[model samples]
Target: MSGSPYAPHTASETTAMLDAIGVDSEEALFDIPESVRFDGEFGIDAKSEQAARRAVASTLADNDDLTEFLGRGHYDHYVPSVVDHLADRSEFITSYTQYQPEVAQGFLQALFEYQSMLVELTGLEVANCSMYDAATALGEAATLAERLRSISGTRVLVPDLLHEGRRGVLDNYVAGSDLTVETYPTADGNVDREALTEQVDETTAMVYAENPTVRGTIEEGLDTVGDLADEHDALFTLGTDIVALALLEEPASVGADVVVGDGSALGLGSAYGFGLGLFACRGDRELLRQVPGRLVGASEDSDDRRAYTLTLQTREQHIRRERATSNICSNQAWVALRTAMHVASLGPDGLVELANDSVRRARETAGRLDELTGVQAPVHDRHHFREFVARVDQPAEAIAADLEAEGYAVHAVGDHEIQVCVTEANEQALDGFVAAVSEVVR
Candidate 1:
C-alpha cells in the first residue's frame, strides 16, 4: 500500500485479493516476458515548458512548406473563424458526456442541433449525435444491418474504390461477426451497374457506396444502386461529406437506409486523421433502436419547457454489454460541436453555395491541368466534386516528388496517375500549384 499510492487496497486486502486469485505476489500476476519488460530508464532530459514549445516548433518547421492538394477521405474545406470562436468557449469545449440532462442542457442542445442538421442533410428520420469517424460509422452500419430483423445475409458489398484505411477498419470491425466484406467493380470512378447487378443476390446484407467516391468523382446512377439493393432485400448505405450532402441527391430519395460520412469536412479543415462520423438512418423504430452512438432528443422538462437530453445511449458503457448496439466507448463531441457551429454559421444557402464551389473548383482545376502537355486531367468521365485523378506522362511518384520540391503536395495514386483535391481553402494557391505542376510534368 505504501509503494502503490494509487492502489486502493491495504496490505492485508491486497494479500487477500492475491490469495483469492491464487497468486503469491503481484509480480506473478503479469505475464510479460522479462526480456521485453521496461527497465524504466528513459534517457531524456526534462525541459522547461517554453523550451519544449520551441523544440516542438523547430521540429514541425522541418516539415516541407508545401500547399497540399491532397484529399481522399480527409478534406480541408475552409472553416469560418466564427466556428472556432464560438465552439472554443469553455462551456462547449470542457463539457464531457452529458449523463445529467438537467445540468448539461446547453451541450446536449448543441448536439441535438447537430443531429437535426444531419437529419435534414441525409433526409433520414434519425441521426445520432456522432460516432468515432467514417470508418467506425460504416462498421456500425454493417453491424446494424446484421441486427435488423428486416434485413439478412452475411455479405457486405462495397465499391472497389473505397479508401483502404476505411476498408481496413471495416474489415477489423466485421472480423468478429459473421459478416464478410466483398468489393464490386467500378466503371470510370462510378459504380458499375451491370457488374453490381451480378453481385447482388439473396446473400447480400448491405450495399455501401460513396457519392463522390474516394477518387472524387460524384457517383452516377446512384438511385439504381439503391434500387438494386432494395430488390435483393439488402440495406443500401450511402456515404458523403456534410457539404456535398447539401447539393447531391438526398440519400433517402435514393433509397439509402443509412448514410455515413465525415461531418468534419466542413468544419475542422483537414484534421488529417481525426474526423466526426455522420451516422443517420431511416426513422423506422426498429432502425432507430439499432442505430449506433448517442442520440440527443428534444423533449419537455418538468416545467413544460423544451429541453434536450442524451436520448438513446446504445453504447456498451451505458447499457447491458450484450444488449449494447456498439462497443464504441466514446464519441467526438467537441468535433461535432465545431461542425454544428460551422454548419449553423453557413446556413442553408451558404452551404449550398460552398458545395457548388466544390464542384466548380474541381472541374475548373481539372480543365486547367488538362491544358498542360503530357497531363490529362479528370481521368474519370463522370462529374467530380472537390478532387479528381490526372494522368501524367512521367512516373506519378517522381512527378509528385518534383511538385513537392516546387512547394506543392499531391497524391501519386498510381504509376502515372495523381489525385488532386482543391477547395475554397486552397483556391488562392491554384495559380502557383498549376504553374508548379506544369514545370514538374514538363
Candidate 2:
C-alpha cells in the first residue's frame, strides 16, 4: 500500500512494481539530491471540494479592486454579457485547436469570421486566426520579413519609443537568426522621419512603427516611412490597437506591408498574460503562405453546403520541421472567439461610437489634468487615443503610490512621468482619478 491516500496501487502491487524496476523504494525512483530534497510534509490538508472552493475564494477576497487608469499594451474594456455568455459554452471553452475539419466546423467558422473582421479593419486581404499576443505577433513579423528572398538585409528598424515588452520579445525571436535589431530616434513621441530615412538601406529587412507609441503619442509621417521602406526594399510593419485602428486611418492606405497588434480591446478584459493577437498582410500569396499560425477559410462540403476549415497551418506541428514558419504550437482561439462575439454584438456603428467615446474621454481627461499646478499634461504635443502621459514635479513612483492608496492604479513610465488611460469602462472614474492625483502632487 502506498503511503498517500491518493495513491492507487495496493502494497503488494507497489512491491511488485518496485521489484520489477529493481528499486527498493518509491523515493529511489527520483534522482534528486538529498540536500535539496524537501523533508517536511506538505502543509495542505485534504478537504472537501466545497471547503476548498470557499478557502480559495476567501484568499482571493483579500485583493483590492483598484480603479485602473493604466494602459500601455493591455487595456480594460467593457465586455458585454453576450460575449461572456457565448464564450462560456462548454463546447467553446474546453475546445483546443480545430485540427479536424469535420468536427470543428463551428469553431473554424467563428475564427474565420474573426479573420474576416480583421481584414475589414486593417484593409488587408488575409488575416491569421491566432497569435500569442501583439509582442509575439510583431516578433513573428520580424521572422516573416527575413523570409523574403528579395530583401537581402538582416537588419530590423524599430522606433526608439517602442514598448519595452515588445522590444524584448522581438529580440528573443531574432536571437536565433542572423537578424540585427536597431532603433530609429523619435522626435516628440513620433518616429523621426529624417533618421528613419537615413537608417533604411539595402541591409534593412523591415521597418516597424507603432501608431500610438508607448508614450501615448500618435505617430505621423507613416506614408514617408512606407516610402523609405519601399525605397530600400524593406517591409513596412505597423503595430497598433484595434480601438485606435477604428479611429485612425487604415494601415493599407498608408502602404503598410504587414499590420500586427492586440485584438483584445474588442471584447477581452485586462487580466495580464491574456490577449488576442491580430496579424494581417496584403493579399499576396507569397505573404499569405508565410504568415504564422492557422488561417481559417470558407469552403463547400460534399453536400454542397457552405463550410469552414483550417486552410493554412504553417506551425511546426502541422508542417515539416524544416519548412515550418513558426514553432508557436497553441493559438488564442477562445480569446479570438470572445472578440468575434463582442464585435458581432456591437456591429459597425457601435464600435465606432465606442472608439470615439474613448478618444473623447482621454482628451477630456488630459485637458483637465493639464490645469493642475505641478502637472504638464499631454507630455507629447500630438493627438492621443485612449491614453496620455503627464509630466509632474514629484517623482512618478511616489505619485503612483499615493494614487494607489486612494484606490487608483496608473503607470509610472519615467522619473516624473505617469501614463493615464481612459476607456468607456473607467470614464466615470476619471474625476476620482484626477482628484487623487491633485492630492498627491499638492
Candidate 3:
C-alpha cells in the first residue's frame, strides 16, 4: 500500500518479485537499523517562508566577523562587480548542459572561451569546460593516467605535502583500480628531487606535483621533475590555480602531460568548500580521447560563421556508457563562465600584475612578521605566492586561537608553524594582523 501507485507493479507482482529475491518485504532488503529509521512524525511546527528566512538570517548573523588569512587551498580574491552583473543574467546562470547545439550557442560559446583561456594559461592544447573542483580533477587525472595506453605502471606518485583532501580523493578514485598512491618527500617545501627520483621508476604511472605547494613555497626544480617523469615514461601532472599560471612557469614547458587544479580562483572568492576544477592536457590524440568532463569546441556553421558546440563528452551519460572514461555527469559551466568573465576583465597585464602582487605581498608580510621577537617568518627558504609558513615560539594552535580572539584567522599547520595567506582582499588588515600576531606571540 505504501508503494508508488505508478510503479507498474501490482501487489501480487511485487510480492512475487520479493519472493523470488527471498525477501519478505522491501524493507527487509535494506539493513537500516530500526532506531535510525525514518518514521512519519510532525517533529516541528512549519513556518511561513518569510519567518524561515528571518530565522536563518538571524542564525547566520551570529557568526563572528573575523578577518581570515586562511588559505590551505581555499583563497579569497576580489571579484569585480562586472563579473557578478554579467554572470547573473538568468540566461547564463540557469542554462543546464548544452546538449542541443543549435539553441545552446550562447552558453556553448562561453564555455568554449573558458576552455580557450585555460588552454592559453596552461600551455596545454585541450582544456575541458569544467570539473567539480581540484579534488575531483586530480582524481580524474590519476584515472586518466591509468587509462592512457602509453603509460604502463601501477604506481601514482604525489608529493608528501599534497593536501589531504586531494590525496583522499585520489585514493578513492583509484580504489577500484590496480594503481597505488604513494608519497615522495619534499625538500624545503618543494619536490625532493633525489627522493622523487628514487620513487619514480618503471613501476610509476604518473608523477603529480603542485606549484606554490600546499606549504606556500614556490617550486624551483620543476624541470628536473619533468625530466624524471619522462625518463620513467610516466605521465607528469601539475596542479595550480589559474591566477598563478599567468606568472609561474608554463606547465607544458615543464613537461606536464596533464594539468589540473582550481580554476575558480579568479572569479569566485573564498568558496571554503566548493571549487571549480581546471583540467587540461597535451593535444596528443590518445590523451584527448580520455580527458574527463566536457570540452566545448569551436568550428564554422552552415552560414560560414564561427560556431561552438560540445566537442567531446566522455562522461557516463554520453555515448561512452559502461566504458565511459569518467562518471562526471555534470560540469561547473556557470563557475567557468564567471572565471572567464573575471579573467577577461583583468586582461593579460592585469592578471600579471595580480600575480606579481601575490608574490610581493607574501614576501613583504613575511618580512613584517619576521621582525617580531618570537616569530621567524617563512619557514621554507623559497619564494612564496600569496602565503607562507611562519615559525612561532608559541604553539601554532594557541597562536591561531589567540589570533582568532583578536579577530583574525590563520592556519595552524604545524606545532610551531602557522600559515598566513595575504591577498589584495585582506591587505588592508595586514598591519592590524601583524600587530595582533606581535602581541599574541609575546
Candidate 4:
C-alpha cells in the first residue's frame, strides 16, 4: 500500500490480475503441482526507522572492522569525493549501452577516453569497449587467441597461481566449444618456465599469465611467456593488473599480442563491483578486427567536427553467430567512466606516485609484520606490487578473525597465509597494522 514514484501498480490492480489468472489468492497461485505451499508470515518484529538504523549499526559495530592490509585482487584504496559526485550525475547514472551514440555523446566520449587512457597506459594500439571484469576479459582474450590461431588445436596454457575465479570463468567460456585450457604448474610462486616451454607446440592457441601473480611475486616471467607463445605461433595474452602498469612493465610493450585486466585499480569503488575490464590488442588489422566487443573511434561528422561512435565490433551476434568472436556487448560505460576519471585526475605523475606508494606501503607493512613471533612473508623479492601473502601461526581465517576482533580487516588467501594488500597502506596505517599483528600473534 506504500506509494512511491517508481512503483507501478496499486494493490487493486495486482488483485484484479490475480483474479483474472483464476487463482483465488496469492498463496494459491504459488501451489506446486507435486508439493504443498505454505502461507505464513516471516517472524520478525518490525522496528521504526530510527530504531532499525540503530539496531543495524549496533550489529555491525559489534565486529571490529578497521583499515586493511590485504590485496589479493580486491583492494581498498582512496576514492575521491568527486567520484561519487560525478557518478551521481543523472546523465552518467542513467545511461545504458551506446545504442544511441549520437544522443549519448557524453557517454561515447567517456568510453573513447577510457580506451585512450588504457592505450596510453599499456602502450597498446587498439582498445575496446570495457568488459565485465578482468576475469572475463581473459576469457574473451582466450577466444581471440583461438580465432587468431583458427581454433583447430585451440589449447591455451594458463600458469598456476592464476586466480581460481578467472579459471572458472575461462572454463565456462570454453565449455562446449572447440577450445581447451591446459594449466601449467608453478615453482616458488612463479610459473614453471621450462614446463611452460615444453607444453607449447604448434597446436597451442595462447599463453596467458598474470603479472606479479595473484600471490604477490613475479612469475616465470610473463614477457618471456609472451615471447614463447609467439615462437610457438600462438597469441600472447596478458591477464594483467591494469594499475600495476604504472609501476611495472607494460605487457603490450613486452610482446603481448593482447592485453587485458580489471582496471578496478584505477580508484574505482567496491560499489562498482562489476569492474572495468580493460582490453587492448596490437594494431595488426586482422587481430584488431578479431578482438571482441565494440571500439569507439574519433571521426568527423558531416559538418567536419570531431565525433565519437561505435565503429568496430566482432561480437558474432551483431554480424552472424558463427562469425562472432564473443557475446559481450557495448559495455560497462559508467564503471569505465569512474576508471577514466580516476586516470585523468591522476595523470602520469600522480599515477606513478600512487603505484609507488602502494608498493612502499606494502613492503613496510610486510617487513614489520614479518617480525611478529609467528608470522612471516616467505616470498620477499624485488618485483612485488601492493600485495603480499603473509603466513601466520594460525589458520588464515582464524588469523583474520583475530585481526578483525581488534578492529582490523585482513584478507585470507588460503589456509595459513593471508594476502596483505598495500593499496591504501599509509605510514600510520602500516605502523598500526604492524602493531596489530604483533598484538594478535597469539
Question: Which portions of model 2 show Cα errors greater than 4 Å?
Answer: 1-46, 314-316
Give the distance in Å from residue 256's predicted Cα in candidate 3 to where it truly belongs. Answer: 0.7
Alpha carbon lDDT of residue 81, candidate 4?
A: 75
Count of clashing pairs, candidate 1? 0
User: lDDT scores for all predictions?
Assistant: 0.89, 0.86, 0.90, 0.75
Instruction: Put down candidate 4 lDDT per residue, 30-148, tens digits, no spaces.
Output: 54864555467697676767888999999979754466665666655677878768877998888777667778788789889888887887888888756888788988888777777
Task: Kindly list the per-residue Cα lDDT of model 2 for residues 199-261, writing each as its tens digit.
Answer: 899999999998877777777779888888988989899998887777787899888988998
Model 2: pairs clashing at backbone N, Cα or C within 3 Å = 1-11
Per-residue lDDT over 365-399 for candidate 1, one digit per residue giving the tens place of the 0 to 100 score: 99999999989999999899999999999999999
Error at 345, model 2, angstroms:
1.5
TM-score, model 4 to reference: 0.84
Deviation of model 2 at 148, angstroms:
1.7
Pick the winner on TM-score between candidates 2 and 4.
Answer: 2
Flag the better candidate by lDDT, 2 or 3: 3
